[model samples]
Target: MKPIGLDKAEHAHVESSNNATVNSEKLDLSKVKVEPLFEKFVDFDTFTKSDFRIVKVKNCEEVPKSKKLLKFILDDGSDKERVILSGIKDNYSAEELVGKTLLAITNLPPRKMMGIESCGMLLSAICEYDGEEKLNLIMLDSNIPAGAKLY
Candidate 1:
């Protein structure tokens, strides 16, 4: 593939620089599929109504007896700890997620999953890779403090 705004030599340099840390062969996107972008548009006012914030995971554990759920105890800069349940057990283990910073929509109304009240929803990227579904949580930099609002 041709690189935009870069000459052949410059593009080769960039690709070589990344090869030390990234496998260039896996950069191919031909087998990956993503959902179509939303056809409907929302006004800025309506879009800003959703509260997106950075939250630190204080604890994460599999919801007992459930195969797809993971319960998260989060620090959202509030006095009370926030609890959100995400169906990501298949993608990540609780031990691997604790203490990680993540993005979440914190203003959603509470909903019960497995009889537990989930107060918010964590953001994730979902797509089909080589005909198989994949999910990845939206992780944030560790230096970003919890409760920081996203514009």
Candidate 2:
């Protein structure tokens, strides 16, 4: 196979990104505006109120007629299986998430979405790449037991 050179536009795009990162540290941002979601900081007392537990995804499946919903059956150290509806179907496959250990926020009241009751939330990491949003569900190593409290 032959190597391809950047065809004008690609070269300029790469050059701009290189410069952007190099000069980012020197930029002035005292007047910069941020998204509302990132504007506030939660107090420690309020943050500690959330109950975070380690859970294993025993089963995972897509929610019918939904583009961004996935239904997960989690083993959270409880006698019954805990169900959580997540908006991560676009980011992960059912096969990729099954049998994986993850951190879940388990104290929230159940909410009905698409006619299903979700008992908790699965934490995920979000990032931006080339102006596009990317997400990955937070997972832990297998050594951690299910339902272990997160300190």
Candidate 3:
């Protein structure tokens, strides 16, 4: 379905200028350019469906043959340890991430990468400055127990 005043096909690689015709009158369009606006909202039910849990990083190491992958063993308060692969090796080191309690989405389906099955995803924020990107892992403030559900 297409929304009102939001057609992408009409707006293409066309060039623009200050001069334009309007009913036999010259109009300066440079000052009256139409800037597209976007507003997307996610419903509450869809937002709450994600299972967020507190997991402690029991172990972390760089994935072999991959410069961007970092393998982590997480303690989710369960009997079996969980495995998560993150592409944050360029931002954080293995020694810095180990033994740290962080937020993770634990309900996602396991994904295999480089023969390793990642059971969860670590939460991080990407900050951009001067065309450079910095990824910082999200760490909770309080001393939350492992596998604690986030409401």
| Ranking of all predicted structures according to TM-score, beginning with the best and ending with the worst | 1, 2, 3
For residues 72-119, what per-residue lDDT tens digits would candidate 1 score against the true structure?
999998899999999888778899789999999999999999999999
lDDT digits (tens) for residues 1-151 of candidate 2: 1111122223312234233211123212232233347767999999999999999999999999998899999999989999999988777777878888999999999999999999999998664444445465777777899999997
Identify the candidate with maximal lDDT: 1
Each model's C-alpha lDDT? 0.80, 0.76, 0.74
Q: After superposition, how far is residue 109 of candidate 1 from its true place, in Å?
A: 0.5
Clashing pairs in 3: none
TM-score of each: 0.83, 0.73, 0.71
What tens digits encode model 3's per-residue C-alpha lDDT throughout 66-136? 97899999999899999999988777779967878889999899999989999989988554422445455
Candidate 2 Cα outliers beyond 4 Å, as residue runs: 1-41
Clash count per candidate:
0, 0, 0
Model 2 scores worst on lDDT over the 10 consecutive residues at 1-10
What's the lDDT of the predicted structure labeled candidate 2?
A: 0.76
| TM match of model 3 to true structure | 0.71
Backbone clash pairs for candidate 1 read none
